[model samples]
Target: MASRVTALLLLGVVCFGFAAAEIVVDCCLRTTDKRLPLQILDSYIIQDAGKGCDISATAFITKVGKKLCVSHHSKLAWVKNYINILDKKKGGHQ
Candidate 1:
């Protein structure tokens, strides 16, 4: 009975460790340089490199509920403009 209790405790710790690791994993491993139309985008989330991610990125959610990760350093100015548009939509100046 003692051994069975120890096995269950070990299993619980292993499961909790896996769950914790999943929480910190980066969302975007690769980013796209392609520019998307603002009309299709529903909103955007900024993925900070400081928050366990390798690179800073913008994950845009489309109207149909799809996520598109884009590089923050894309040469085109449209990405920045789109972010501004999204901010304005949320009534935020930043």
Candidate 2:
């Protein structure tokens, strides 16, 4: 019984960690959700470019039943903003 409890506890911990890594947010928006084209992992590696959550514009595309990772030096917020701006400006490549 103790071993079963321990195993369940470990499994819960792992799942919780994955859940946290899979989603990101803004001051008023959720950028990633379960039903999206991408699943984002936690990105904590930055070259001290000064604060306010610097992330990469690129995202790691892990297909179903496959493993993949992508690395890039641009913020996710920047990408969202750029996308919004382009969208608002009647769809031009910026």
Q: Give lDDT per model, in order.
A: 0.78, 0.38
Judged by whole-model lDDT over C-alpha atoms, candidate 1 comes out at 0.78
Candidate 1's residue-wise lDDT over 1-94, tens digit each?
9999999999999999988873656478788888888889888877877687777888888889888889873544788888878888883221
Off by over 4 Å in 2: 22-94
RMSD of each: 3.8, 13.4
Clash counts per candidate, in order, are 0, 1
Error of 1 at 40 (Å): 0.6
As for model 1, its CA RMSD to the true structure in angstroms is 3.8
> Which runs of model 1 end up more than 4 angstroms from their true locations?
1-22, 73-76, 91-94
